[model samples]
Target: MPGSEHADRTEDGLSIPRHRVLVTGATGLLGRAVYKEFHNNKDWHALGTGHRRARPRFLRCDLLDEDAVKAVIRDFRPDVIVHCAAERRPHVVERNAEAAVDLNVKATATLAKEAAASKPGAFLIYISTDYVFDGRDPPYGEDDTPEPLNLYGKSKLDGEREALRHCPAVAILRVPVLYGEVEHVEESAVTALWDQVQEGAAGSCMLDHCQQRFPTEVRDVAVVCRALAERQRQDPSSVRGIFHYSAKEQMTKYEMAVAIAQAFHLPASHLMPLTEQPAGAGARRPLNAQLACCRLRQLGLDVQPRPFRTAITDCLWPFLPDKRWRQTVFF
Candidate 1:
């Protein structure tokens, strides 16, 4: 295979076959990063699927359709399947419980079944969330038992179960709040605070001192996913099972707002910290979701995530070329 050094060589010792990788939800925030990572890498042929948004590089596939999922796997015959499609919005899941169940759990189950039958060495990589931990503890390890707080977390936990049940040797990456260059910052929870800090606008930020979290970069998560795929090609056994990946430092929403305002040169005086819960919230969240990554580093993946302060530029990226503190409006 393209990822393996043991492949048959040509006259000059160049491998002929290339690794095939399929990434679902290609147009989404994190999915876009993962697909781009595989596409830019020369050793793999990356194919991605999209739903509402269509493009030449993307294959339009509705994950909810079991037949569509089967057709894509059978035709592409991918060596690795990165399942990233899910109904992630907490309030949306609360309102549309059936839709969440169909997409988050049922679709994942469909993909796992197809991947298992397609090839013996086919690897199923499911992207999970740290919300599986009810934020009651700190620095949760890989073996920590999950106690989700809301529907979104519950759905993801159910997805994990389905993935493991169908594809016994699946690799799961449970991550925290991800921020990266996307169509809109709202795709990420923490980065979306930039929107709230509008010019001369006053807003109340929750004094969520008890609820601690880390904002991980989507690009960083993508790097780890690609590394796992490469390692799987070499030794499938090593990459199997659940793995945790997140930012190095954890901060509460209140603390993060202060830093975010400083980075964007916004006023914190108006962004008052309120101890009471924010109004119109349908779901309860984990108070502390800090993912531990010691095991991932031990695997020799060479994935060292950037610090929150240094990665601020990475979160805004090409949109705001000059990352210095500037009084500017970000949509």
Candidate 2:
């Protein structure tokens, strides 16, 4: 019934059928990229849903509120729903377990249910994390058993289960550390390394060298999401189940810091790599949860990642105190 409405016209005033894409947590790092990707695509119309930071283009909706979520789905009737809203912070999830479950698990279930009940039954893409796998044995495949190290990972795993349970056609995408355009450097784990690099420049600073992370770019993940959405749109049963999408490049926090220092031409003599994990932490982190991109590659999707050195430098350029240095290094 939703598709019976008059089709929108393209630039040439030719009628073009468009897929309605709804992205949750549009204000967040990955959500922003996903929203932008769909918004820019000529084949689809994107509507981003956010809470605190909701803007003119984004719809303001608190995911925790079941009524609000149902209303959003019922009204929009999106053909594809990219669910990115969740309590992703490990320490924060540890601090507030109830809130994490409510947002991560309950909200996901509600969204999946609402999407499934929609007129055309929207294809859902649930954004998960590599933390679902305990860093014991990796790279983890699609069917690999998930053993979460912390509550954050467990919550995400639970969210994935909820999404799959309600919507069988859901695509669960698990990614590692993400970096991209950010309102602030502290927003992303990889970009936050610049702060550590700055700290190291002044005095002795230690970063985790033990844990290996495949830092994937948000824009790349957005592309993957778009591809998956297109695949699902073409054939509903084609894209389903768990999918791992991550960068091939591997680097520890210490290594990332070193790279940041080198890019900014800062002194790295004071930087030290901690070989062992710190004691008495709020939540335990995986040593290395390298996600295998076998499923994505097999699907003929572009799993290749941008070069870390060049990408990271470009991402951090705006934050550089001196703009003159960018003309020489970046330009």
Error of 2 at 75 (Å): 1.3
Model 2 CA RMSD to the hidden true structure, in angstroms: 2.0
Backbone clashes (count) for model 1: 2
Q: C-alpha displacement of 80 in model 1, angstroms? A: 0.5
Write model 1 residue lDDT over 167-277, tens digit each, in one string. 965899999988787677677787776655553354554446556778888889999999998888777788888899887777776677777667666677756555666
Model 2 scores a C-alpha lDDT of 0.88
What's the count of clashing pairs in each model shown?
A: 2, 0
TM-score of 2: 0.95
Q: What is the TM-score of each candidate against the true structure?
A: 0.88, 0.95
Q: Say which candidate scores most in lDDT.
A: 2
Residue pairs whose backbone atoms clash in candidate 1: 135-288, 211-287
Window of ten residues with lowest summed lDDT in model 2 = 1-10
lDDT of 2 by residue, 176-295 (tens): 999998889999999998887877547899889999998888999999999999988777776999899998888999998898888878778788999988798679888889988887
> Tell me, what's the RMSD of every candidate?
3.6, 2.0
